[model samples]
Target: MGNFLCSSSVGRKLIMSLSGCFLVLFLIFHMSMNIAAIFSEDAYNMICAFLGANWYALVATVILAGGVIVHLVYAVLLTLQNRKARGAQRYAVTVKEEGVAWSSKNMLLIGFIVVLGLLLHLYNFWYHMQLQELLGNHTNDFGYSPADGVSLIRDLFAQPVFCVIYLVWFAAIWFHLTHGVWSMFQSVGFANATWYPRLKLISNIMATIIFLGFAVVVVVFYIKSICPACCVA
Candidate 1:
């Protein structure tokens, strides 16, 4: 098993698929949590407080980070192997119009965009919240308590530019996940002709649900802030 994971292409792809699936589930949970902030700041803050500076959350974070690292490293290795295998013949292949051709070809680009967005998000939220809690600062930009996730999100989205940027990032994430969710299954050999369409449909539904959950939070908060009397009671 260890040798297969370290040396086999199929094993590496399996690991990627497993990690990718776990991350997708995490994204769904995260988006749901963020969406709660739009409806009630206190609820969000409670969640932040619950998750903050805790040993369990820290352990989960470390495991998630390790999964990301392993997935990315294997992805690079797979790409390199693919490139070497296609050497001198890589560009000579005819463009084939197969199902999901476009997404398969652009997976790496989508992955890159997702990674970039995650970095920006970590800086904006995680660094301010969990990291600050771990560091014992416990105060955020709006002078609200670090556990006051409502204030953090509201203040961030109140800025027009940041809201727009966040929306854009969400859009990228939507696209990435739309492709990634199905592709992960495909990599694991579940995307046969009989199941391909169903898999794609499921992937699209999951992606849309996650995207709208996060997007609604940002859009609703931005609108509420702009028209406080109409929104805030």
Candidate 2:
């Protein structure tokens, strides 16, 4: 079955859709977890600690990594196939694709930016946090416990540059998810004329929620760090 799937175009797309769905769910959970920090530092840190360096967490991380790799690999394969099939079309005067969103056309580019952002994010958070704990360092270079996500957030967002970068990354995520969510359903055969619009609506709503949720975390922490008087009573 696995070999057959890899050999066929449809099977590879199905695999991409499945893995993409898995990662989408994880993003929702991750955004929710970060939202907890806005209301309660203890709750956020507690959740962070709960998910750090433990066997279950490690297993989940590995699975998540596998999904990302699979999705990316299939994406490249699809792009190459399309280019090869449409080699002549590349030079023809392109007619605009009516009703298709801009994101749909540029998914590959958006996906690449998203991947780069994820790498930067991992370097900023995962390496300093969970990876530290996994390596038996109770505290990071800043002397805060590796599980001390509150401290990490405060210090990291203190720099306006990083805040801006994160906001830009989140914007890229918005574009990616808007197309990705509905497109995944379409790939799995849910894109009939009637259902396509509805799925697109749902996709926009989800993409907005995720972007706003993540942006809030970065912006709020940055504000707090920049102006203690505004945050502190």
Candidate 3:
């Protein structure tokens, strides 16, 4: 079954679409969770504790990792196949904007940047917090409890360099989603002309909401770090 599913162009796209949808669901939950931090530290930490090293959280993490790996692998495979089919014409393109967005043309490059951002995020939070708990360490390397993720986020974003990097990461995500969301719909047979523009609009809305939600946490925490006297949490 696995061989049959991955041995054809349509199967490859179907796999990508399914994995992309799963990831989109995860992103929505994650974006909502980040926004919770702006409302209350204790509330956010409660969520962190709930998702910490538990059986369910572990399961979810593994599933999320699988989705990421499969999506990235299939994307690379499909791009290589397309390039092979296009031959020299792949590089012989003359004047883009014939129709597709630039993001569609450079999705692989954008995906690479997104992966870099993910690594930075995992280093900052996952390793320090979840990995510590999984390893049975009561306190993280930062000398804080594994459950003290709020402080981790605050400290990471306090650094101007990390803050700027995260914002740039968010920008890349925005571009990727604007193209990806609509394309996924089209891939799965929603390519009817009447719904095309509407899907594009929906894609943009989703991308903006996700970017703003995640960005708010980073920007807010960074501001509070610089001026604890006045800024709200």
lDDT (10s digit) by residue, model 1, range 152-183: 77778889998888778777777777777887
lDDT of 1: 0.80
- Model 2 lDDT, full chain set: 0.89
Query: Top model by TM-score, which number?
Result: 3
Model 1, residue 129: C-alpha shift (Å): 1.0
lDDT-superior candidate, 1 or 2: 2
Task: Mark the 10 consecutive residues where model 3 has the least summed lDDT.
Answer: 88-97
Q: TM-score of the candidate numbered 2?
A: 0.94
**Per-residue CA lDDT of candidate 2, range 23-49, in tens?**
899999999999999888999999999
Per-model TM values vs. the true structure: 0.91, 0.94, 0.95
Model 1 worst lDDT window (10 residues): 98-107
Give the range of the ten consecutive residues with the poorest summed lDDT in model 2: 87-96
lDDT at 138, model 3: 95
* Clash totals, every prediction: 0, 0, 0
Candidates sorted by lDDT, best first: 3, 2, 1
Judging by lDDT against the true structure, name the best candidate.
3
lDDT of 3 at 140: 93
